[model samples]
Structure formats: structure tokens, C-alpha cells
Target: MADEKIAKLVKRRSCMKSKLTVFGNYLHTLESCNELSSLQLLDLETRFNRFGSLYDDFDKLQCDIEMLSEEPDDEGEEREQFENQYYKLVAAARRLLGARPHQSSQLPDESVASCGDGRSGGFKSNCVRLPKINLPSFHGHYQNWLEFRDTYLSLIHLRSDIDNINKLHYLRASLKGSALLIIDNLDFKAENYEAAWNLLCSRYDNKRLLVNNHVHALFNVEHIKHESCSAIRHLIDVTNKNLRALSTLDQPTQYWDTLIIHMMAEKLDSVTHREWEEHRNTLNNPPSLEIFITFLSNKADLLETLQENKSKTKIHNKNSLDTIKNHYNQPTSTKYTQNTYLQYNTNKKHNNTYKKSLTCPMCNQNHFLFSCEAFRSLSIEERRQKAKDAKVCLNCLRPGHIETRCNLVPCKYCKKKHSTLLHMHEAETTVQPSLPVSNLDSFSSSTDVLDTTTPPIVLLSTALVRVVDSKGNVHTARVLLDNGSTANFVSEFLCES
Candidate 1:
């Protein structure tokens, strides 16, 4: 019986060590797993719950310590005190476990070491922590997604430590299996985006790694800057030449121009080639991919009716407004199909599944998206109520208060509301009526204005004339305009007289 008791104690201690070993190991390995998707981390955690015993052992130890404290004997008193202190530790251990559950599947092969020593603020080789991301696929993915992704990828690739690299890769592989890290901010200035792309693409000697990372570049279809257009064209040309370069990227590697045109129709529903021409020609501006796609897609819908006219395959493939989207996402049988239509479908039905990639804040679905009708109505109604609650301006229709707080002032001449008196009274008609005749006596309309040809000769007196140089030096001379001699003379005052 004594041997059995000791063996049980030994076994519990070993279990405690193993659990701590597993938990600590995970935290250490996962610290660098920023590149992995949330789903992948969850999968790892599901597996770790099977072998980690830190929590249970801590609980058992605490119970034993508490039971000893209940005894009144002197020997039990010391044991009880130790047990009480140990119970506090057990409580702490339980709390920690509750907060960070086992998130690793198989302890990442023990080959990958944990990050930093716990003393140095880094956990020991065995320290591991489970990850927790509530909205894994599509949360807070505004314009900075690409910048974040590239920065993360760079950190992983540049890491010199092999163990760190392995941990990173394992985490990344798990993430890629579950999440599509769609880059949102690719619409930045072309130079900046290109710079980021160059950095990410630099380490790409192998093509498969690039695709596995799911590097998707999102670019705006419309840009007014000439330099930006030129850069885009150049990028599109490069993509054309190296289609393989984009084979692995999550976004379609089609020419940017083509993609822009497609996305333009998708985002705007009432566009036409003629309208596109007007925007391109008049504004020297291209429509955004979203807007262009929306318009073209609409046009395609109209053209489908005029089918006596032979339609291009691109036109025929345009999705109808009322078409069922159920099968629209299934992976195509071949790469050609995938390339032609860059969409995929899954069987799983998540409540807010549409929120998986691009989410609609209104209904929170993956398909209808944030711009969908259901969400748009909700947004509009909410905005209207908010404006009503805040007492929006009646005239300007702006939010955040009434017209009393408006900076607008009444214009004196036009009797219209303006921001300032200076803006109102600076009118030409106001200037004409306000001028004093005395102020005009010495100032000739012609002389008051600048004459670049020659500095105006200032008649100091009837005989003396002066001119100022560019350096503001005044040169005065005596001159006579004499009718008697029929000559003009430049001389000293005495000679002139």
C-alpha cells in the first residue's frame, strides 16, 4: 500500500511535468506562428488536449495538500501550510488553462525548439501557448492587409534560426489550410505596392511556395496618376510574361487591365463601354475594378437579350443578376476553369459563413458581402436614425448637430450663406462700389499695375525724373521736355534750367 501510494505520487508528478512541458512547448513554438491562420491553430489545439496533464496534476496536488491541512497534528500543520500554498498555485494553473486551452494537434515534432528562455522573457524550449482569434478569416481586414502580410512573411523568411523557421512554417501551413489571407490594401500608390511586392517576391526561387502562401494582390481599378497607370501597365505586362509567377497566388494573375475591367463591372451595375470611354477621355481617369466590373456585368446582362448578335465568350459568361449562386463557388475541374472564374465553394454551412472572407457588416454573410442590398438597407436606416438622433443639419444634410452650429455666415452682396465675410465681400462688384476716389488720384490704373518692360519713370518734380532698378536702387536725373528746343535733355538741374 505504501509503495502504491508513492508510485501514484510519482506518476502525478510526471504527468504534471509532461503537461507543463506540452503547454510551455506550444506557447514557445506558436509565438512565431503569426503567419498561420486561426483555423490551423485550432486544429493543433484539439490534438494537444489529449496528452497535456498540467491542469489535472495541479488539481490532484492541491487536493492532497488540502487534506493534510485538515489534520490537527503538528506534522500535519506544516504539511497543511505547504498544501494551502500549493492550492493557490493549483488555482493559478487552472485559471491559466481556462484562459489558454491546448490548441496544438500533435506537439509540433519536438525537433522545433521553443522561443526564448522564460527568464529572459522568452519561454523555455518546451513552453507553448495556444492561440485565440475569435473572428479568424475576416476581421479588421481593411486596406493594411497586404502590408501586414508582407511584413509577416518577411519576418518568417528572414529568421536565421532553423527552429524558429520550422515553427513558423508549421504554423503557416496550418493557417493556409484554413484561411485565405486576402490582402486589402494593394490599392496604395503603385510605387509603394510594387516595393512591397518586390520584397515578398525576392525570396521566390521556387513557384509553389509563393502560391501556398496565397499571396493575393488587390488593386484599385481606377487611378488618376499617370505614373500609377504606367506602373500598373508595366506590372500587367510582367504578369502576362510570367503567368507562372502568379499561378500560386490566391488572386487571379490575369493582366491588371483585364482584372480592373472585370472588377469594375462587379462593383458597379450600370456601366457601359461608352460610359467607360467618357470617364477615361473626359476625366483622364479610369473607373475602379469594382465599379467597372459592376457596370460591365450589368451590360452583359442586357446584351444577353440581344442574342441575335453573336456574343463573345466573356460576355456569355457574365453572371445574370438573378442567377443562383449555389454552384458558383465549387472548384472548377481544371486549372483553365479556375483561371477563368476565380471563385470557390465549400459544403460547410457556417452561420456567418459569408463573413469568411469579405464580410457585410449588415447581415454578416460571405456571399452578399458588405455592399449587398440587405446590409446596405440596414446601414442606410441606421445612418438615418443616427442623423435624426444627433439633430443633423437641415441645409447641408451633415451629421453632428443643428444649423445653429454651422460656421456659415450671410454674404453682404449676394445675400447667400458663406463661410466668411472676406469670401463674401471680396466680390468684384463690392470692390468697385467700396473704392475711394481720393485713393485713386495718384494711382493710374496703368501705373498702379506692374509693367515688366521698364520701370515707370517717377516724375519727382517737373524737371527731375527717377527710376528704380530691380534691386530697389533709385536713380534720379534732371530731364527737360522742352517745346522751344524741340529736344529732351538729361543733365544736371542747373544745365536743365
Candidate 2:
């Protein structure tokens, strides 16, 4: 068995030597040809294939020799000779194949599988195939360097097919803008992929600068308007963008919830701010950024709903008020003049009665003797004149009393034992002639024939009146007399009694 193993190793070594010789001759022939034909190219391709196959065999043989050698002291010289020969042949093959020194060490998948100890020559069944990753493209921004480098190294670096030579292509393809300029300055003929990758790292993989830039960007996000849905969406998008950038910088984001929530909250309107405050108070634990964002979204939805409802309510109220005004103010055709006149009279009568009811001395309604909005709204001089005309006492400004026997203090200006306003009243009375009061009995007899064409004069006064009921009962009542009234009004309580 020992002799057979020795003969097998010798035969394999001789076969490899012969193949190398043939490959060398083919290379010589190709180099000598000025211009290659299709046949020559085909022969070159075949020679390359053969050379690859021989290299795989030599690799296997090298592994076998190391395993079979018991001690370096005994078999070291022979093993060294074989290893030198193998390396020389491999170098020559690489030169012929136009492969760099770094590329020669990488084994293709087909070669690795074929050399494995299995009849089917497949990969180890126990091997776990990693899922392929599609890395995001880098455009020379220093901000993106860390992510791009990490993803590229983790995914592409482990692949056997992407050797250092192929890595050059990938690195160039991945770069853009200033990154391309960086590679352009390097002597690519001398620099390998690792050297170029290290150069890129040295320039852009500054953890401190990157962290500062990302943090600054996060803090300096633009203020968002809170008018529309698009504005709110834009705010969320800007916040998410900054957070994602920070995360990419490998900064811990778990502690950034407060900062992010504050930044987002600053963009809210008054209503949304109140909503956030209420929601935040109800939380047992401090709210996260995501929870705060959800609150804003819900608040925005509610605000939109309320705005729509308020608009609808305003429109409905406006339409109802307009309808009521039109029904009350619009007149009918000329053919119904009598009906219109009668309606006018009825309305006038009702309005007069309403005015009288509202004009109690103590209440602030239309044109009362005291404490009314209309009276207060009048100018000072108008108020004074109105008080004098109504025979209201200047001290208390109440009716049914003259300035003398008022029992109030003397005037401060004239030092007379009268109300303060009595001086102004006397001056005005002196300037204008006073009308003499006609006898009530003579005036009533003269005005016995009432004129229907003219509006009756309204006289407001206090009078003693007799009230008679259907049962022939008579009662004396002190009443407010209004002469303009066409019909007598009896109280419902009195009629019921």
C-alpha cells in the first residue's frame, strides 16, 4: 500500500509538470502571433480551461502531501520542492490568464466543489447559505459612509466570486461625485482593493464628525406649519428622516425619545398641543416618540372633523336666520294692501306692548326711565335732557318727583338745597319757553272726534283706572296710560279671577 501511494504521487506530479509545459508552449504561441484568428482564440480558451483544471489538481495534491507527511524533519525537503514547483506553475498560469497576485488566492465555487471529497462534488450539505443583500448606493456623502461600508463589507466581502480584482470594479461602481475623485487620485495599478478601502475609511469614517453632523441635523429640522394634512405629513417625514440618519450613525436612539417628542411637539398648533398634554398626563409611563406621533395623528383627525362640523353648523344657522328674516320682512302683492295694512297695525301694536313690558324702571331694556341699555348708550347731554323731559328727579334720576321736596343733598355748584342736576335743568328751562298745561277735561272734550287718518299721539303717564269684569265687579287699579293704543288690554290673571 505504501509503494502504491508513492507511485500515485509521482505519477500525479509528472502529469502536472507535463500540463504546465504544454500551457507554457501555448502562451508562447499566443504571444508570438501578431494577430489571432478564431482558431487561435479557441485554442487559447482551451489552454486556459486546462490550466485551471491542472491548478485545482495541484491544490488537491498539495493538501494531500501535507496530510501524508508524518514529520517535517524526514519529509520536509521533498515537500518544500513540490510546493515551490506548484507555486511557480500557479504564478505562470495567473500571468497567462491576466489575473493579479491577490486574485490567484481566491477559489472559484466550481473548483472548490469539484475538489471536495464527494462523488457528486457538491458543497457540504451542512453549509448554511446566506441570504443575499442589496446594499443602498452611496453617493460620496460622508453621512452615508458608515452604512455603505458596513453593508458592503458584510455582504460582498464574504463572496468568493468577488475577489480583490472584482472588488475594484464594485468599489468604483458604488462610488459617485467626490468619492470617485478620491479613487481617481489613488494609483490603482499599485493599490489593491484593501488599500483603497482603507483610504476611503481613513477619510470619511470619522465617528465624531459624523455623530456631530447627524445630531446637528436632527436639532436643526425646519419648523412645520400646522394648517393642512400635507403640512403635518411633511413634519412626520422630516422627523423620521432625522431619526433614521442618527440610527445609521450607530448612535443609541432608545434615550432620544424625549428629544424627538419635544421636537415633534413644537410643530403642533394650539389644539394639538393641548391634546398632547392631556394624553401625556394619562400615560402611566413616559410616552415614547411613536406614541407621541400617534397622538398627533389622532388629534389632527379630530380637528379636521370638528372644523368640518363647525362649518356645516354655521351654514345651517345662516340659512335659518335668512329664512326667518325674509318671512317676517317681505310684503305680499298690492292686491292685499288692506291685509298688509292690518298686519302692520297688528305688528305695531304687539311691538308697542312688548316695549312697554320691557321698559320697567329697574330693568336694562329699550328706552326705560332708568337702568337700560338704550339709556346708557345715549350721550351725557342727551341723558340729562331726557331726564328733565320725563320729570325725573335730578338726584336719583327717577320719575314722579320734582327737584324741590326731593330730600336729597344741595347742589355742589350753586350751593342751593336742591339736586345737583337742578341748576342745569333750570338754566335750560329759562332758555326755552315752557308750554302751559291745558286742562285735562277741556282737552279730552275738544279731542272727542278721533282722526283715523293720522297716527294717535302716545302719552306715557301714571293714572288711576277702573277695571270692570264680566261678573259686574269693579276694581281700582293704578296703571301706566298709553293713549296711542286702539284696543284695551286686560290681564289674563284678572280675567281668570
Alpha carbon lDDT of each predicted model: 0.40, 0.60
Best by lDDT: 2
Candidate 2 C-alpha RMSD relative to the actual structure: 26.1
Model 2 residue 488 CA deviation in Å: 25
Listed per model in order, the count of residue pairs whose N, CA or C atoms clash below 3 Å is: 50, 0
Tens digit per residue, CA lDDT, model 1, 1-497: 65566557546655665655565565556555545454644544354444344455565764564444434375355445544544454443333333332322223334333333323432233345545322122132322333445444444434333344353343234233113232223333433444433433443333455444333332333432322223334444333333343542444654465554544333332334345566556644555544544544444455454543445544555654114344454445345455434422221222233234443333545433223464233333453443344343432233333444444344433544421111211212221132234533433443333322222432221344686657777776434232223233332322333
Q: Which tens-of-lDDT digit does each residue in 205-303 have in candidate 2?
A: 887888787677667766655555556666776677666767776878878899788877777766667768888899999899889878667656776
Q: After superposition, how far is residue 308 of candidate 1 from its true place, in Å?
A: 39
Residue pairs clashing, model 2: none
- Kindly report which residue stretches of model 1 are placed more than 4 angstroms away from their true locations once superposed: 1-52, 56-155, 160-263, 266-497
RMSD of each: 31.0, 26.1
> For each candidate, what TM-score against the reference?
0.20, 0.35
